[model samples]
Target: MDSRRAFLKKTLISGTGMALSGSLMPQSLLAASSKKITILHTNDMHSRIEPFPDDGGTFANMGGMARRATLISEIRAKEPNVLLLDAGDIFQGTPYFNFYGGELEFKLMSKMKYDAATLGNHDFDNGMDGLLGQLPNASFNFISSNYDFSDTLLHNQFSAYKIFNKGGIKIGVFGLGIELEGLVAKENYGNTKYLDPIAVSREMVQQLKNKKCDLIICLSHLGYSYQSQKIDDRKLAAQVNGIDLIIGGHTHTFLDHPEEIINKDGHKTLINQVGWSGLKLGKIDFAFGKKNEISYANSEPLAII
Candidate 1:
């Protein structure tokens, strides 16, 4: 939680006062002042509904959905404006998914109030038709900017981008998925055309900027990084100009802190990913000041113990 404290110190004192006058301000005054938005995210949660077995293996007895719900509830109870997000791979690991075909996962995420999520390679495991059958169960929006689903069964099931206004601060969020070729079976995705993530991101960011978004976040399932010339979150950060934070999935990398990279425009971009199976929750706090000035203040990666 305290990992990003240093960045907060740069915030003007007037902006810092929002933390003091949290809930007791007039509506108009609150709108005029700085606002805080908490972002909680998860990735590669491959249908581990229950905690791991109590055996002495790695992550033993760790990461259950109930515990994650409780933790999210506690945090939301304290923070007025919070966004819950998922990077992807929300299906196909445990027997729960094998039996239910993602109905349970969608029901649980709806109950937990997930704002949005992207697509991962394994999410296609059940195939397009299988995924369509479970769409009615999810209350949250599925966002994918690059994958052209017009020829598939999932057409119009997902939004390319969404804008959320939290405490008068406009936050723009979009999704980026990894290439499905060689990763997913052709029969599974059918005619879904995969567009270049970098190109799509460039367009989305410009649109968000045009809309005067105070913050821009990319929910990515392109993995953290790779040795070869594969497009990862880090590469996207370097290429994209306006993305402020990238909540990523795949490769199941457990990052203690977000990797900060300077973009082509020399603006800072953050990339954070929690390990698979819901062992931990990644939190990023965005505090907004006058004009479009913003600060990525704190990160509280809480373990679901």
Candidate 2:
């Protein structure tokens, strides 16, 4: 799970509804009408079917699946162009996972109408068999570029990327995962081969660009950062180009605000992560002006409460 407690504690002290004003807009699009896209996200929920206890804690009485579902439904009601996504670690925290082995998680997420989701290493805790066994319940797509599941049961079960058409706006999304070698138990992972996430992500992004996607998003489980040479989300953002946003998980980093880093092409890339256990839901509203320039950007981390 992400440091939801840490992020919530920081954000509450700083103030809520923090806004970013004055985004760069193309002169040609200044007079044109705008299109709105709302991106809603969560990560590392770990099958928390119920809200946390009311005991004194940062996430107490927060992060119930029902609350999240209600919030998502309300948002959809307000905005027709919305994308609901998850960054992974959807299994193995609550008793639901121990008893149902992720079936409940998949079923619920599917019912929530998730646009897409990536996989976390913990997703293999019950072994590849367990993960693959419950695939039928999830109606959304699983996009991953690094994992070569060809020899495993997940071969055709995942995609490297997907392009979504929303109100004439083309949004492309891909997924990247962490190295499983020594991190994941061999028996649990089976024959799944992990590749270089950065390289694969770059390639996928390039493909999406060639397809002329209006927006590109990367769903990553490669932890926020590390002292070692391990590649993290920040490193990926700096090394790659054309990625508009990186929604990350693993290491459960709760970011109070989205970090904007310059990518290889010198364009800004936004990276955000919500704390784990479904404690918070991340929402970003993008207003696209004429000529496809981003006119406004606002992000809010909604406490499950």
Candidate 2, run of 10 with poorest lDDT: 11-20
Alpha-carbon lDDT, every model: 0.85, 0.83
- Compute the lDDT of residue 15 as modeled in candidate 2: 29
TM-score for predicted model 2 compared with the true structure = 0.89
Q: Which pairs of residues have clashing backbones in candidate 2? A: 1-252, 2-252, 2-276, 3-252
Q: Which RMSD does model 1 reach against the true structure?
A: 10.4
Model 2, C-alpha of 293: deviation from truth (Å): 3.2
Per-prediction TM-score: 0.88, 0.89
